[model samples]
Target: MSRTTALDPLFTAVDTAAFTDRHLANLAAGTLAAVRVPDFLGNAACRAALSALDRLPTTDYDPGRVPTPIVRFGPALNDYRDQDGHLDAERYWRDAEAARVAWHRAALRPDPIAVSMGHLSAAWGAALAPATINGRAVFGGTLREINAGALIHYDDINREYPTGLFDQEVIAQLAFNVWVAVPPTGGATTVWRHRWEPADDHHRQAYGYRSETVEHCQHVTLTPKLGDGLLFNPANFHAVEPNPDGRRIAFAFFLGLTTTGQLITWS
Candidate 1:
C-alpha cells in the first residue's frame, strides 16, 4: 500500500480540464495552482473589457476612504459599501450589465466572465454530483486598479462573516481573478503559504497581519497575463506588488464550498 502525504495543491498550467471538483475544493482547502486557460477569452476581449471599464462611472474612495477608484461590477453583494462618490447599487448594476454586453459584443463571443463563472460552477457541482450543490453563488465584487502595490496581508483574517457562509467549511477559501489589464512591469501577486492563527496575536493588529508575523514562511509570486485567470487560497498571506509602469485592473471574487454540500461563488 502507498501513502499520500498531506500537501498543498499547486498547479501551473494552460488548461484546467484535468482537475476534478474534489481537486478544486481540495485546492481551496490545501492546494495552490495557476492555470492559464488558453485563448480562454483571448487578449483582444481582455483589451476591450479593460477599455470599457473607463467608460463606466467609477466610485470614489471606499467608506474608509481608500482613495482608490472602485467599480462594483455585476450585481451587488451583501455588506457592499455604498461608498461616497461611488455609483449607487442601481447605477452600478445597470452599467455593469451594459459593460458586460459591450465587451461580449466586442469579443465576438460569449461574455467570458459569465461563461467562465458558469463553467466553473458546473464543474464544481459535477465534482460533487448527487450532493445537490445548494447555495447562493452569484457574481459581483470590487473591480479596481492599482498604480502602486499592496502591502503584504492575509485576506479575511478578521472578517465578521455572516451566519451560514459557505466558506466557513474550512478556515480557508479560494479566490478568483480575471485580469483585464496588466501593467508593463511590477504587477505580480505575492503569496506566502502561511495563514493567520491565534499564535500570531503578538503582531496581529486591527489594520492587518503584517508580513513579519510569519517572516520565516516560504512564498511564491504570480504575474497575470492579459485575459489570464487565477485561483488561490486567499486566506493565506498574500499581497499585490506595485505596478510602476501602468495601472493594473482586474475583476475579483471569492469561492468555496459549504459543509452542507453547497459550492458557492461571490465577490
Candidate 2:
C-alpha cells in the first residue's frame, strides 16, 4: 500500500452479525475503526465461562508498571518483556505452561477462545495460527477484569520488539475482545483516531499516555454488553472507562495479518 495524500475521514464503528473478511481487511487497511458483534457468544456459554473463572488463577499486573488495578488470568507476552525489550523467555514459558494447565482445569464449556478463533478463521477463510518464536507457539487469549479501567494506550508488536519477537512477520495488527460479563453502567471502550507520535512522549504515564495525548483526535466509544465481541486496530490510542457497578470482564487477544495473507494470534 502506498501513502496517498488523501485526508481520509476518522474511522467509525460497525455492528455486524458475523466477522467477515471485509471487516478484517478494512481494519488492517485503516479503513474501519471497529467491528462489533452483539451476543457473539451464547448467553449460556458466557455464563459458563464466567463460572469457570472462579477456579482459574488470576493475578494483578505489577503496580510499579501498571498503576491501574486490573485483574487478569492467562499469560500475556507483553507482561513478560524485559527492560531491554527482549522477552523473559524462562519465566514467560513457565507461566504459559501453568496457565494452559489452569485453563484446562477450569474446563469452560464451549471454550471462549476456541469459539472466537473459529469465527475469525471462518471470516478470513483461513485457519488462524498461533504466533511462534523459535518455532514455539506463543500463548493466545487472556481473561481480564477491567472494572477499574485501562489507561489510554496503543499496541504495536513491531515497535515493542523492534528486533522482532515472532517468527512470522506482521504487516498489521488488530485487537479482539469478547465480553463474558459486563457492568450495568460505564466500562465503555474508547478508541481515538490517534497513533503514537514522537511528541506524544511528553504525556507518557506508566504503560499508557495521558488523555491529552488524544484530546484533539476524533474517536468512537462502545459500551460493552455481555457476549459482545469487538475487533479493532490497537495501533490507535484507546482506553476503557471505569465501571464501579459490577465486574467487567473479557477474553482478549491480538491478531496479526502477515505478509503471506495469513492471520496469526497471541495474547
Candidate 3:
C-alpha cells in the first residue's frame, strides 16, 4: 500500500466541544473527514443509556451475510433490502415499529438518541425530521454492539436505492454515532478518503470490500470513547477495528441533507 506524501486538506478530522454549522457544512461538502464532539452526552446520561441496554432485546445479524456477530436492537434498512436493492417495506415497517416499542419499554432516561438529535437540530438552526417514504416516517436511531468489529464498507442511500427511496431528495448523507460504552482498547473506526468505483468490485468480499480497496487513500481513525459523538460522510469507505476487551455500544443513525436543505434522519 503506497501512502500519499501529504494528507489532503479536506481529509482532516475536526474535534470540537459541539457540532457547529461550519463543521456540518464542511463535512457534507466533502471538505472535512469527520467531526468529533467530546462528551456529547454527559456521564450520567451515558450510564443511564448503558444500564437500559441489558433489558433491551438484542439480536445478532444474519450469520450467513455478516460473519461477524454484531448485536443490535433496531432495524437497519440494509437488512431489509432485497436482491435487486429494493426495500422490503412490509417487513421493515413491522420490525421498525416493534423495535420502537421495545426501546420505549427499556425506559432509558433522557433518551440518548433524542438528546443527540436535539443538539444536532440546534446546530442546524432547524428541526431535524425523520425521512419519510410516501407520508410514513422511517425509523431513526439504533443501538449496536460491535465488539468483534465491522467490515470495510461505504453506505450511501442514493446508491442503495438508485431509483430513490425517500420522498425527500437527499443530496448528501452523514452517519452519526454516540457511544454510551466503549472498550478500553481497539474499537477504532477508520474512514478512507476513497469512494466506490467500478474497478473496486474486484476486491469485494462478503458485505464489504477488502482492505486493499483503500490501501493508498488518506484516512482518519477515531477511537471510540464513552459519551463521545461522531459524524462523518458514510459515502467514504470505512471499517471498525475489533475490540478484544469490553463492550462497544453506540446509538447510531443516518442523516440526509435534502435538496431543500433539511436534515432528515433514518437508520
**All candidates' lDDT scores?**
0.56, 0.93, 0.93
- Candidate 3, residues 98-214, lDDT tens digits: the string is 988998899889899999999999999999999999999999999999999999999999999998999999999999999999999999999999899999999998899998888
Of candidate 3, the 10-residue stretch with the lowest lDDT total is: 1-10
What is the TM-score of candidate 3? Answer: 0.97
Candidate 3 local accuracy as lDDT?
A: 0.93
Of 1 and 2, the candidate ahead on lDDT is: 2
Tell me the lDDT of candidate 2. Answer: 0.93
Would you list the clashing residue pairs of candidate 2?
A: none
Candidate 1, 93-137: lDDT as tens digits: 555566456544554233455656665666676432111113322
Report the poorest 10 consecutive residues by lDDT, candidate 1.
128-137
Clashes of 2: 0
Q: Tell how far residue 255 is off in model 2, in angstroms.
A: 0.4
Tell me which residue pairs clash in candidate 3.
none
